[model samples]
Target: MNPTTLKLCLMAVLSLVGIGLYGLMICRNLIKMVIVLQILVKAAALGLILAGQMSSQINLGQSLGITVIVADTIVAVVGMALAVQVQRRLGTLDVDALSSLRG
Candidate 1:
């Protein structure tokens, strides 16, 4: 692909990353924030993969992406479980509303 096209794609990825981060920061709901955070993480992984591949380091890029994907899956599953438990116990998933910790 041409450098111009690559630059455009990078810009688009960066824009998505920015929007995801902004949503994560501004969202009051736990689920929305978590989803946005995941998006941000994925965008970062994409950026890393793109950079690595552009450098002719395909193996390195694949390895890095696999690691990130694995970590992301684990984190997302655990976080979702925790969020569900919290919502059930607290009756809401709002961050500010959560204060009492169940022993």
Candidate 2:
């Protein structure tokens, strides 16, 4: 890629990471947290791919990106499942409410 293209890709990756971090910090819902985490992981994967491209190791970058995708999917599924259970048991999706609960 040209210098301009590389710069753009880096900017995109940084934007995604910033947005994800902001969302994670501001959101109180478990489901939304999971979505934010997904965004963060995607940003990481993009960064890995960009690094691979910069290093002339496209295949390595692609494989690592794929691995991140697979792991992220599993995490999302589990997070959603937990959110469902929390909603059913507590009748609220608020993180503050969940934090108050004890064994």
Candidate 3:
């Protein structure tokens, strides 16, 4: 990749991280938090890919990206399922409300 392209990728990764953190801090809804978490995970994968590209280890980067995606998908799915149960049982998805759970 050209220097310009590398710079662009770095900027994108940084922006994604910043946006995800901001969302996580400001959002109270469980679903929104999950979405923000996905953004952070994607940013991490992107950073790994960029590192691989810069290091000329394309295969390693691809494999790592794939693994990250798989793991992130599993986590997101489980989180969503739990969020659904929380909404059903507690009648709310707000973090503040869910914090009231004793167990």
In lDDT terms, which candidate is top?
Answer: 2
What are the per-residue Cα lDDT tens digits for candidate 2 across 1-103? Answer: 8999999999999999999999988999999999999999999999999999999999999999999999999999999999999999989889888776577
> What's model 1's lDDT at 10?
96
Per-residue lDDT of 1-103 in model 1, one digit per residue for the tens? 6899789879978998999988977898888787887898888788878888789897898899889988987888888888999899889999879756656
Q: Per-model C-alpha lDDT, please?
A: 0.85, 0.95, 0.94
Local error of candidate 3 at 47, Å? 1.0
* Steric clash count of candidate 1: 0
- Candidate 3 least-lDDT 10 residues: 94-103
TM-score of 3: 0.92
lDDT, model 2, position 28: 98
lDDT of 3 by residue, 25-57 (tens): 999999989989999999999999999999999
Worst 10 residues of 1 by lDDT: 94-103
- For TM-score, candidate 1 versus 3, the one ahead is 3
Error of 1 at 99 (Å): 5.6
